[model samples]
Structures are given as C-alpha cells and as structure tokens.
Target: MGSCENQEFECKKQKPLLIEGPIIVGAGPSGLAVAACLKNNGVPSVILERNDCLASLWQQRAYDRLKLHLPKQFCELPLFGFPENFPKYPTKHQFISYVESYANHFSIKPIFNQVVEKAEFFQSIGLWRVKTQDFEYFSRWLIVATGENAEPMRPEIAGIEKFDGTVVHTSRYKSGSDFGNQRVLVVGCGNSGMEVSLDLCRHNASPYMVVRNTVHVLPREVFGFSTFGIAMALLKWVPLRLVDKFLLLAANFTLGNTDRLGLKRPKTGPIELKNATGKTPVLDVGALSQIRSGKIKVMNGVREITKSGAKFIDGQEKEFDSIILATGYKSNVPVWLKGSDFFTEDGLPKTPFPNSWKGEKGLYTVGFTRRGLLGTASDSLKIARDIADQWRTIKDTKNICNSQIALQM
Candidate 1:
C-alpha cells in the first residue's frame, strides 16, 4: 500500500509467454463462442478471464427474473444449442447452466482471474503483446472477445454522491426483495429497466421508471409469434422500412398508443433505430401491463439526487428509498487495447458489423456486432475459419508446445 510497494509492483516483469495460437481476452459468451469455434477448426486458443468464473455477467450480474429476450435457439453459441428440454426462453439459472455446459463441452479451460491490463500489436516482432496481471503473452493472433457491455454505464447525475439512499446499477441488483416495499426510482427505459421495474412491482414495491429519451417498446410476442422472430423472418422478404411498418402497426394494434402512457416511440422505425444506434427496443414481457395499470410510474430524467429522493427534469420532486440504474453498458476495449485503428474510443470496432469482426494485424473482435448472440456466432466462425486457414498456410509448428500454457483441448 506504500509508495515503495507500488514502485516494486510497477517494476515487476513477467517472462514473455509465447502462445502457439491466438490469445483470447474474456470468458463470456462471446469468448466462449470463438474458443469453441476455434477448437472445431482444428486450432486452439487460450482464453483469459478476469473473473474467477465464466460468463460472469450471466452467472453473477443478471437479475433473478432475467430470461433470454430471444428464443434459446437464437441465443445459442457458435457450435452448441441449448438442451432440448430447455424452454424457448430460458431463465437466468438455465442460461448459466447452458453456458457452463457449453464451456465444459468445448473443454475450454480459461486461465481465471487473469485481467488483461494492456494488449498491443508490435509490428516489429510480428506478434501481439498481451499483458495480464500474472502473464505477458506473445502470440501471432489476438482476439478481443470481451464484447459490448464490459463495464456498467452509470450516468453522472447532479448530487449523486450526496444521495443517502442505496443506489446500485443493474449489475449489482439481484432482486427487488432486497428492497422490500420501498419506493424505487429506476433510471432508463431499456429492457433491463422495464424488467427491473416489473420485478419490483412483483415484489410489492413502488417502481418509477425514467424515460430520458425516445424508445421503441414492442410486444415481446405478437399473436403466438415472437416479435423478434417476425422481424427476422420478414427482413428477408421485404425491406427494413416495410418490416418496421408491419411491426409498428402490429404494436399499435396490440399495445395501442404508448405515448399517452409516457412511453414514447422513436421517430425512426425500431429496426432502423437499432441499426443506426445500437439501442435495442424494450421487448415488453410484463412491464407494459404494469405501466398500463399505473403500477409502475414513468417519469422524466433526474435533475438532481437528494438524500431523500430525486428532482425530475420536469420540475417535479419525489421521495424514494432506493435507486436502480439500468443505464446499460459499454465496451472496455479502449481502456486496455493499445490501438486506435481497430476500435473506436468507446471500445467498439471502428468498422460496422459483418466487416467489424476482422481487423488488420491478425486482430479480431467478437460480440461487437450490435446483432447480439447471432452476431457473436457469425464473428466467431469467421475468425476461427480465417485463423485456421492462416495457420494451415503458414504451417508454423516450431513454437508449438513451447509455452507452459498449451492448448489442452
């Protein structure tokens, strides 16, 4: 804790650990998908997870009531499907079980608790230098699979520190039972925000959600068909506009006018808005009815947070016992990856999806594709195939089995 210890820690050096294949950073679904795909391609990779367990977001951060927004099939990783008995939309626990099984099935043994501090491609050495807490890895290929949502995106509110109430991000929130019958102010109107509010309502808590910007609220399903399913099926037949029109018409008929209920729709179509901006529309499970019945109050953005409650930008003040920030997450790629060419300042691939998976200098990105699991699968397969082709062409096996960390699987 002293200056001397800090200096020594900074001065400490790790032997350059050479990796035969690609070095993966992260052990989440994205990382798992790529690792599995790579194994299938006859190539091996080393996955490094900062956390002790795989899929920490799903295993630890997810709420008790969380379920796959999409069907299980659509959410499956690269080379695996959810168990046949698993429901169309598996619950939080079921998804975690699937993730563990997926990792085990692939024989993935990620070095746990190895936080990637920095990763840089050295043109001189023709390799990537990945520096973690315990290892400095050198490899011809480096895969950034941390994906989107690496870190919680907490908003900067005036007087937030002065608030006496228990304020926590959705990452830390597990259940509304934790708050009992307290008045909870839920910020953001995204899927997580809506679901969290719905959960609070079930727990007999008064939940107020904040709608700071325009959002698209579509029924999770429409007439025995999943809304997302319909969108995907229709996109192939018609243009995005027609698909959006049908969706809005269906939404208008099913949910009626949400504007009067304080949930405003964006001017652009849901699909269009999502394509332009990675903001996904809230797939209402039960929150719409709660909002309709006035069980969950919708309010404007907060102007300031007081000890008792928060003052809304609409010039209104209300008291609350706690605050739940469903403000969402952003990529942490920029923080550690030492480059500006491949990724943006916000930590997403500079290139868009489809093309976003591959970068120059043998660097690849998975899960940055706003397309969710489907995108992750696409990126993973492409990366694995490309790496396999390159490896076969080079036929470089001289350094194989040289590193202590061998590709066990």
Candidate 2:
C-alpha cells in the first residue's frame, strides 16, 4: 500500500490504480479528445464513463432527426478530421460513425459504465483520488470532460404534475411520429424546439412553439457559405459588432423578418451573447419556413398548466395533447467532483474560454469552453503537452534523488 492510501478508500487490494498520465472523466467527445492527445504524447490515461457506450447522450437521448448545427469542419475533435465525403453538416448517425473511427484511429478505448462518485485532490500527497463504484483511481492529473450538457435542465412549471398529457424532455423525445395527430406545446425557441416543432408539423401534428424570450435565429448558411465560417473569418479582421451586423444583414436579406413571425432578436448579438453566456443562437435549418408558413404557431410564455391544456400569460387557453420541454442541459460536475475550485456552481469554469481548460493543482477541463468542439481541440492539445512536460520534469527529479541515495550508500 502507498503512504497516500487512507481510510477514505479501503481498497480490496491495498494500492489504488495509479494512472501514468491523467484520469479523464466522461467518454464523450471532450474526454476522448484528451485521451487521444495524451496517447499521442506517449502518456497513458484511463477514461471513466457512466454510460454503457460512448456518446450515450447522442445515441440514447437525442432525437432521431438530430444533426450538427455547426458545419462538420467546426464540430470535429482534435487530431482528426471528419471524412471528406461527409456533408458540410453531417447527420447524427454520420457523426457517431466519425466518432467511432476517431477512437479506432487513436486506439482509444474507454472503460465503460464506471460512474465516478467523487473526486478530490490530496495536496499533501500531490495526487488525485478518483473514486468510482468499483475502483479507486489515483493520478497526478484529473481531466474533467463530463461536459456542459451532463444533465437535462428540467424547469418547474406551475401545475406540471396536474397536466394530463404526455410530457417529456427533448432528451427523451425520439421522434415526432409518436406525437402524430396531436396538439403539442413545445416550451422553447432554441434549435431543438424549432426542429421538434418542424418534425411535428411533418408528422401532421399541431405544434405551438412557445417563444418566451428573445432569440438570435440565423440562417445555417447564407449565399451557400457557412454562416459560422463567415463569422469566424470576419472576426479575424473586423470587430465583433461588425461581424454581428454582417450576419444580421445577411440573415434579414436571406430569411426575411423573423420578428414579424414571433421570434424576436436579442439586443446582444449572437456571437457576443454566446461569448458572454454560453447561449448558442438557434441556427435555422428549415424551421423558420414552417414558422413563416404558420404551420408552427408561435405562442407566449406559459402562465399555468391545466390538466387538458395550458393558459398563456396573454390569457389565451389552448388544449394540447402533449408538452415537449426543450429546456436544454447543464453540467453535473458539482454532483461528483468535490473540493474543487476550478468550476462554479453551474458546473462551468469560473474563467471564460481561451483560458478555461487548465486549472490549479493538476486539474484540467475540456469542453467547458462555450466554444464547442473547437474548444475541445484547443484544451486537449494544451493539456496533453503540459502534462507531458510535467511528467518529464517529475521523472528527472526522481532520478536525481535516486542518484543522491546511491552516492550516500
């Protein structure tokens, strides 16, 4: 048993499993990115995933018609590119296949179904104790990649329990086919809400999209060019506000006045708002057309839920057969990772992007950057290189100590 071993973890075996590099939490894209980069640097890591398979949220929880909102180029992880044959915006299945190939290419296999109960750093020992259901993992570095969307944000609606209809979160929503021929109230205006309503319309369901707040809805592409790519290019030379103006102008010229239809624009520009608070603007695919066509009716905020329907703040009442909450997700880091100063109560790094990855006391986080997969790539590379450098220094120090002991003998 090591001197660091304590009553905190009475292992069946005396010693805890010491990882050679970092202990990466979550086998989602972010975790995989770190693991692959570590492997590239000849550092070994163990990935702990709570689910049975990788990308469980995408495969198990996401809707059937889901696809990457950003172009596939921006959505790819570190050290790998999406297949050249893939579309600019790949479908969910295509994306999953790419993930599998990426894992295979790097020979990165994660230990599945291992839920991390708690993780705390022992400063005296200069190691981290990563406790899971069955094993205790000790490592010099801990990489938290559980991600921003670790848990679904289920809002408390007034009289929700009394709502006598099919109620489910967007995570559990498989398809609109299940909601055919019913009046569905979708309580959001984000990409998911818009897409779900559009799907419902396709399935012959009456959908009322509740747009409670201002949203920045941009065309996924403008003039056959990726809107995001254009924004990135513009931001390099032009100011962010100028980029926002260009995007808004292009969106207005392309998509027409979305405000007239009900979804109003936020005073904060899309990119600026996204930067300030990790809120991503809704990238319009085909949902706006439905909203314009009046196939998807836009409604006000929900005031109260009735057994048969809902009463809006406008005092309008509509009978609905089902309610779909497209409320989005939050990080679950606070629930498991203990005694950490890296993350806030909301499970995001207190520090913002471009500097959010590396934390104190050998703690690192990926995908906490609101910047999405691009952020994952940046964090993964930096963390890998940093750990590799530190590992070499530690080995050199240990060798020096050993030589001193030999000389004394």
What's the C-alpha lDDT at position 291 in model 1? Answer: 93
Q: Write the per-residue lDDT of candidate 2 for residues 1-409, one digit (tens) a residue.
A: 3322212334463247776678899989998899899889877788888998788888888899999998888998888999999988899999889888888899877877678999999999999999888778888899999999999999988988999999999999999999999999999989899999999999999999999999999999888899999999999999999999999998899888888998889999999999998889989889988888889999999999999999999999999999999999999999998998778999999988788988899999998998889889999999999999998898899999999999999
Clashing pairs in 1: none
What's each prediction's clash count? 0, 0
Q: How far is 333's C-alpha from truth in model 2 (Å)?
A: 0.8
Q: Each candidate's TM vs. the true structure? A: 0.93, 0.95
RMSD of candidates 1 onward, in order: 6.1, 3.2
Q: Per-residue CA lDDT of candidate 1, range 203-264, in tens? A: 99999999999889999899988999999999999999999999999999999999999988
